[model samples]
Target: MTNNTLLLFSRLYHHDSRVFKEFLNQLPNDEQTMPINSTIKFEQQTSANHSVPDGAITQESFKIVIETKLYGQEDIDQIIKHTDSFDGEKNKYLMLINVHQIHEDYKVKIRNKLNEKGTDVQLIDTAFEDIITSFRSVINEYDTEMSMIIDDYEDYCNGANLISIEDRLMRALPVGDTLDHNFKYKLYYAPASRSYNRRHRYLGLYTRKEIKGVGKIELIVDADYYKESKKFKWEVVEGNKDQLTDEVIDNIVQSMFHGEEEFGYQIYKGHRFFIVPEFIETKFEKVSPGGLLGAKYFDLTDYGLVKEELDTQLIAEKLKEETWK
Candidate 1:
């Protein structure tokens, strides 16, 4: 199945865009090949004149006939209208929206063409900018691995497992409402018997528990003195952010968490003994030195390290950490 798609990728490689092209090339043959009535390049609006491969994507299948200069939602509607004209047993047209001199929002807008699958557009994992960011690191690794092999410029490349880098980016890329369990966190804390005042920097501890389900988690933390309002104020952050703790000294002047202070610094976001607001905001990032700690499904390669290996458990703490609104 991966082999069928590999054909189209080979041609994408020759183009100037190495990252997108290489990613296209590396797609393992997938058996999920759909009947491609035709593929359109949205850069210039026009129909491709090439012959569609019978159940196989060929090298030149991605070629464009005319560079589409259309922009805005109206342009997208026009394209969708045109795409409907193509005879698909089930209208499966592959469209690439590549406007070179545009913003990221525009790119996202292009992907938002909204298809029948409830999905507006499908984005391939690898892209041009990702490769550029990683190019230096990859070259450095290549230099180290094959120093002995390269006698001259002609024989210079080490070409290590570049797929790993691409895969890393792919794993980080969140799709739809589907959350990556790897990015999920869980409960890890000592027990707290009694509640404390908000002014006293109350320490929170969580009893061990597991998380389940699919949806965006809304986090909440109660403010100590919302007496009149009768509403709890929440301390929240993005899905997998972690908080650092430093009970040792008052050097934490601003109290707004001024980065890592010492070695014994424990990690915490809120207290165990307090009630929280219903809807807290995730306003901070790079929360602490602890970073966001969660075990991904893919991280469970070694059975020896695992006490429990359910897919849900793999990132329970993470999902809980993010979802405990």
Candidate 2:
């Protein structure tokens, strides 16, 4: 399944090398094994006079052997064996593409094994998500046929479960009296037991049948609030909590206290908080009746509100002005 996807990309590269070069530039190539001014050709299941069959992207002076795994945890022996395919090439590389990020320890093990054999092939580890993001970044919006190809490739990845649909989603939650408060602190809290999909990267603040604000979620922490002591203790359940500082904690505590006082109840006890570095104003009105209940997920890609290279503020601006298609 994964090889077929590579073949598609290889064929696309053959059609237009310029766009493919941009896509390749997005990948992590520290040693710069990819040739700049050489003729490039892509082959699949090619031996190149070797025993082990692997994909090859060859140039005049360099060769990149691609070993793809639908799942992570590749065989070290097989990978090392692939190094034999490079024969007197000025630049040689062994690219490992997987569905998950290859662990650093695993890469170290591969490097150590290669060293034991005195092999000089450079190793490149990347995930399918990175490839998709890179391809999307370089796609020309005016080229309708190229856009269709990308859509088809993305659909295939999504169908194979190689990519998470939620990553392109923006989940909107209804805000009540705490709308201003949420915007003020760039935080939102709810009961820990509340059932909602939490995989989304962007959160939309919905009120009055319209989304008024949005922010990229930076951290999500589960906390236990003690009203008697006026203290809160939290442990990160998702995102980088290392950025969480004492000042941020104080702000969250103050927000919790204000919620308790306004709602006449302990809203902070056993709650999960979603914190963002900053929230930007937006206006995405909903056409459906009965307002938003619970949470609603919008496909930011489908709406053209997001691109891999776009920042949060740009996305907010697009959301504010663009109408849902």
Candidate 3:
């Protein structure tokens, strides 16, 4: 079914306009819990559907006007013109919502115009991506109705291709076991190669986990810091290996297995190990001794690594299950 942005939002507010209050509290530095019994209006107009605001939530203490543009760029003048329409004595705010992208230039231009007009109306810019993030932030506290509403909104965003790849990676972190203590993941948009005309998506796994016996591990997958064409020079940036007088490589290997029963051991020549061309070094890198020098994965396959070849939606679903746990 075709979903209009306004209708989707109406459904959300229909569930409980308190969600709107929750949303306001979620904004940075706007931490006050708004009073209950607020009223929501759709297609708010000066007379009858004239100078209409996309939506608004008004209460005794505050008024919020939201203008949503899902298909095209928003006209900055629309919001600027509405600053005079607010009649309440409470604090007032105007929010501009977009689906595809938010232009930094738009904010600057609006601020400049407001300054010229001596308008004190506060402006807040947000996008569908931001809404999704905010929803995820509080999904744990949502009741059944709120959860369903979130699911529908998320499905609509995905169907519209409005969800960023980084969003998927961030959502997947809790599900993946290979991550480090923080389970952080970052997605990079790579510039066009000599062959392709457009940029491509690349993901980086910054951390991983292992049994206590394995000591420590770090992984960087698909980052520019390590190249497949180049060999990695491994060093003991810390620990007693740097003080070794002889058999440094052997000593490091011994340290890896000492006091622990592990089958795999890494062997290298001298202080440097040359990675082979066949190794490719694309999927994972085990960070060397120092700290976060190189990128690699720890227990990736078992932890649900989402790669290009893997089904992202499936992994996301699985991760969502893990997140609630």
Candidate 4:
């Protein structure tokens, strides 16, 4: 078969949106639409399972909780399989993850373990670096290259092999001295499977004014999910008028998109998990500093719906949204 069809998305903030949009131009006939006035809709976006101190330590700004659900190992295997299949050769893959969504209980489970185990530091670093050097063995081991982003230095140090700046500099000095993977290294900081070690687009940090004019809310849903189900987190609320809660979204997803028979309810350990992660949509609105955008919902579906509602409500309250068009 021919590989004529290609799918692309802007999953992270650091990723230049232009790269993806440019690909669309190559399509024989492609049409797209975007929002006129967009906010810094994460304009940005992390997945992390944080490790917690036993017996609970001091207070924290936000509570880290874990919500586990049990999914059949077969399901997970299938997911991994599908991920590999879709992220084929030539088309590099990066799991653009929002690591922040895990429940408080789940978040605290991923802390660094102090496994001294009498493992020598030098040996450990050497082993780790050696593993990295031999990790892929050869270039393009399989489908979907892996990269991760860790926000804190602790995780970063633990997860990534400390890149030698001096070594890199010497290697990069003129064309005489350069490493083979330099091209890959220069393009991406890290190639990891889990979001914990991978970078994410943090569009939530900036304000609407920060994003200024990001055009209309052009969105690319999670690839497979978009193709299989013509609905997205935000679309659920917009099209279905759901409350935008996890349970509600789950209900919408199970009832509407993928029926229970086609794909059983995806429960991991004990919590219901969405197969396809959330996507950010560009929207326009005004708000008082820290003013409630009607109501804030952390769940992607609810958040998207609520944000859209607030934008609409604010637009109705103001003449600006109408003026934008």
Candidate 5:
């Protein structure tokens, strides 16, 4: 898996070194580690002088030794051994790419060991998600062929489950007469039995075969509506309920009333309510038939929306003008 990922990077670099450099610039690195006017070389499990094992991106002035970890597993001795590969480079780096952040204690130990060896290599820690983000950031600059290659690489990563589905996916729900209420209160409610392939961090409002709005899911509550008492008993199922204030609760009740008036409280006897701080208006059209029969998930990153610093309003605006690929 690690070699496959490194090969993708090498392919991208060979296609256009500038794009590869831009991708690297987006990663967490020092100024000294940045590549300049030097011939770039991509090596896989090969040594500059029979040292260095994993992947590496080398330049005349600097070298970046990459060690990829699929899980959080780290071997201190193995990592220390790679330090010997950095021989008198002006700027040397040991880039640890993992699915999760490396522990601070491990980083401390690595740094201390490097100091002991008097090696000048800088240790940089990043994740697979970061790599995807950086690559996506520069993807728009390339033409169709290059863009397709980038997409293929991303698809490969997705197939390998290197990028988390839950983190990048947005669940789209169909709306009818309650569309206005959903937009007004930024809430959506449905029967608790509605099946979902996976948990999602975002929600999209679908109406007229088009996604009209999008929002970051702030809370999901399991609610039981009582028609006799004209009230609801709810428990937090996904998010922090403590963040739900009196004003928010009132809005939720209002949304429930609107639903009950149209579909009846019985329809919501045991339901799930999804709440968002605000809904950003959008018009993401569904080109295919069978208009959103059930919950549909779309990978937001597939559309080049950076999940880390995602702007709902910006996404909404982009959706209005751009066609879904």
Candidate 6:
């Protein structure tokens, strides 16, 4: 629904045809013969559904109509209308950019429409995840300004939950050996269904993993479990003690520990998971693990969390010292 995203994509496609072609290659049935250095022209609002396709790319005998989407699911008829504006020549394509998987039925309908019109408008469905990754693949080989743009756009997509996977692994271990065990880690999946207005905002300790069928799954500790146990009760944050009604605490604890029924104690295929923190009010303290997962049962110092961002030399000196926020 936003033109800013379309403008950004148009800029990237025109700026580097190679990256654009690389993105096109993600389509299973696409056969892009446009030269790597072809003189490509990218424009927006130029189709029958003048508003349907966000942009279009043209080079020699190729014309690619690109439609970018984040959460919108346009009807197949909206896309079919684009062929009406086509000149019935060149290698035409209709590309849909979305995060969710496009159903096979829609693809069939699109192909049938194009066939009836006698146009070679092939359908290319590209997930936002793949689009962001394509930009990342060629990000390092670009000029400073272009590189900054791609970097900024990638960050924007990630923040919007359009692309679920994290660029880097959130690990506590250093490159070499592993002798330290100051923090315990939990692997959990944060499905896309929970992306919009997630109830829990204090997902302090977690990592994102890309599952085959599931978009992005987060791996984090069982906060409610760690908090309810006798081992962790002592370290509960004092600020929210009055609000922690017995009913509320019981609900949270039960919800966290109860495994997913559909998947049977796993997210999907042995992927252990936990619920995000909710109704827990505590200061956003970096060193205090008392809010949800308390210091009594687990220490922030376990994974070198406190020392990593502070000071290395100071961390070395306080290797055995307790951490306080």
Model number with the top TM-score: 2
Better of 3 and 5 by TM-score: 5
Candidates, ranked, TM-score: 2, 5, 6, 3, 1, 4
Mind giving the per-residue lDDT tens digits that candidate 6 earns over 250-278?
54344334444322433222222332222
The number of residue pairs in model 5 that clash at the backbone is: 0
- Answer with 5 or 6, whichever has the higher lDDT: 5
The local distance difference test score of model 4 is: 0.22
Which clashing pairs does model 2 show? none
Q: Tens digit of lDDT per residue, candidate 4, span 1-325?
A: 0000001122321243443234222222112322112211210111223321111101122111111112111222222222221211222121111112223222222111111222111101112222223222322333242222112322343444332211111000111111111121111111122122221111121133221111111111111124254544333201112334464344434433333243453321112211112212233343545432221212222222333343323222232232110
| Model 2 agreement with the true structure over 25-52: per-residue lDDT tens digits | 6776546536645477777787744455
Off by over 4 Å in 6: 1-19, 27-29, 32-37, 47-52, 72-74, 141-143, 165-325
User: Which is superior by lDDT, 2 or 4?
Assistant: 2
Per-residue lDDT of model 1, residues 1-325, tens digit only: 1221232232233322444333333322112232232332322222333322212222223321111222212354443344332332232333332211234444445456644425322332232233233333223345542222222211211132111221111011111121221122211111133231112111122112212222122222221223356433333221111332222112112121222232232323333312111111121122234323332222222222242333322333333344221
Model 5: colliding residue pairs: none
Model 4 alpha-carbon drift over 4 Å, by segment: 1-252, 259-325
Q: Is candidate 2 or candidate 3 better by lDDT?
A: 2
TM-score of each: 0.22, 0.55, 0.44, 0.15, 0.50, 0.46
Q: Rank the candidates by lDDT, best first.
A: 2, 5, 6, 3, 1, 4
Name the TM-score of candidate 3.
Answer: 0.44
CA lDDT of every candidate: 0.26, 0.76, 0.44, 0.22, 0.75, 0.46
Task: Give the C-alpha lDDT of model 5.
Answer: 0.75
**Model 5's TM-score against the true structure:** 0.50
Candidate 6, residue 207: the lDDT equals 14
